[model samples]
Target: MDGKRVLLVEDDSAQSSMLQLELKRRGFRVNAEKTVAAAAARIEKEIFDAVVTDLRLGSGDGLQVVVAVKASQPETGVIVITGHGSIDTAVAAMKAGAFDYLTKPVEPEVLALALRKTIEHRDLVGEVRRLRAEVKERRGVSGIVSASDAMGRVLALVAKVSSTDATVLVTGESGTGKELIARAIHENSPRRDGSFVAINCGALPEGLLESELFGHVKGSFTGADRNKRGLFEEASGGTIFLDEISETTPGLQVKLLRALQEGEIRRVGDNHPVKVSARVVAATNRDLMKQVTAGKFRDDLFYRLKVFPIEIPALRTRVDDVMPLAEAFIKKARVRTGSPATHFSPAAAKALRSYAWPGNVRELEHAVERALIMAGGPTVEARDLPPEIASSAPAKRRVKAKPPRKSRR
Candidate 1:
């Protein structure tokens, strides 16, 4: 508690002096005040670790100081001092935001212990809030590594729409970090404190996908032995990321559209609607407009999901991010793999920069991991890279001719 600041508010001059002396002996820096107005002004001017106020002041009650401290800095803990039979009033003060109460004819030792514990609790709460902020900075827009102007615009769009509840559609090639962008939006949103539920729509069959998304009631299906909540309910108060959303059948899209439009969902077995408040953030490598034109995806649902669209440029188009991204991946892997390699040699760096990463960011991460394993020393040589990435400039020209396409008609 050494050097911790405290606000001491008491009308009795003699008692205030004695208490201040004891607190100072215990290493506290006390700012003493005799009235509620003075203490309130002090609180507004400075932030203290804790405030100890007498319940009865000459001009005003201690509750006023408590309210002032809370309004100015909610994290500051408050301890109210009361006389013999003022227990009810002290309780009311606590309800008004005071942390703890002490009876009159205060014992210095007791007051010291209470202040210590209150300050410790306040510190713990402050630390938790700080960690939450770190999450937003680490996982939010600022954490994304990008050097290309196209990527900068994508991040700017993310920043603009993150604080709003608008539905987000992230269109990009596979392995282009669409999910990462979705997470950035969620972390920076007002719903950051809530759960982030993600499901790959194409990974599950239609029946199972429907059940998994909206949950299932017991006896709804052969394997559903018990009632289960769906992803929408689970993600209530937060954002849900739907990957490969274009893979959904038109039937499932109808349920999804209702959920998005009405803020409600129907479980697979139950007819009664269950309300859900999960924000939707959907991603697809396939173009949904084309899907709509081809009669594969619903146009109404497409428009709903496209309210705030963000398209991540392919890695081949943003070649400037390659080397920096490679170095970042290397640094991130060092702690886990304990790899001695810190960077690539001149030739290896050239290969990494020259190659067209059709697989985008995900592919680059894997390539860096591969190089670390293959390298014999602290510096990774060109031979340590994958065969395609290590090839000459002419070979890259052939590979970069066109992005590999998905197997579809």
Candidate 2:
């Protein structure tokens, strides 16, 4: 483990110093305080990785100290030291979020072991909590579902990074769930209730793209009818997803870099600047670094967008997830179209698994829907699939030559 910030609250000077020295010796940055009040002030001012406290400080109960530390920073671990070791107090401390309780005259080895285990357990629990939060947020939205390990990792990263206002770059091929990950981050973040604006950078022309991202005044162009709010302003206190970011022109890249660095955007035909407060998540199917090397994309903009990068894996890479994703899509389609229960045949599922999904999960979804329509029965069969997928079944298996030919030879 790396050096952790530890707040030690103890009334005994010599014992506190000794414990501080031992913790410092074992890769901990110690902050020794004699009173719970002082410890509370320190915790309010700065974050501590863990807190160690004697059960009875000068005039306060260490249980209060544990409660205070946990309240202020729920992520921080608390270890309570008690001299009158009783089962009741220990149970209370643990219930109150104390990572572990140590009795007075505690052995150095025993304390160290408890501290190590508590820290590890706290880290693991934090990770799980973060992941669950991401999943909850992602599921609350409509038309999105995922259970792949790659998506799980992406959610974990999104949870950790969503608390801060950081620029995130989501890289993946088209239909690989980039925008879904971005939505999850936004929904779990402080801006959960705010608007989420998305625009395709590759779909618009240079001038229109600029005007769309940073709104223009009335009569700014031929079709400009009135002063309109751009996506940046519309997404204030929320998130703006820039899809196909690699398609941005050089001039647009410069403008985007300025907006990210300065948090201000100027509308076309308007001299005044508009201050924008929005988290940015840019997604691109192309290799941005390659684009930068080729002088098509700016290096500065690339670096700015990639501050918190997440890569979404294609369906081909996570083939094991096909069946689960298919079932989820079936449920979704059943609800959406008000159709009766629909499912996949074993042959259809086998076909799905064997085929290399060039279009990723999105392709699998469309194929399943198509099969549902074409099937003679309720279940989707291999024959119900399109030629591309159906033709791959026989080719997926290896054919053994006849042994008679070898014998004749």
- Each model's lDDT comes to 0.92, 0.83
* Displacement of the residue 265 alpha carbon in candidate 2, Å: 0.6
Look at candidate 2 and tell me the lDDT of residue 192: 79
lDDT digits (tens) for residues 286-386 of candidate 1: 98999999999999999999999999999989988888899999998877788899989988888888888889999999999999988878999999999
**Candidate 2: stretches off by over 4 Å:** 1-144, 338-341, 394-409
Worst 10 residues of 2 by lDDT: 400-409
Q: What is the total number of backbone clashes in candidate 1?
A: 0
| Runs in model 1 lying further than 4 Å from the true structure | 1-74, 88-97, 105-113, 156-167, 187-195, 223-226, 236-238, 260-264, 275-277, 287-309, 334-345, 369-387, 392-409
Candidate 1 accuracy as TM-score: 0.73
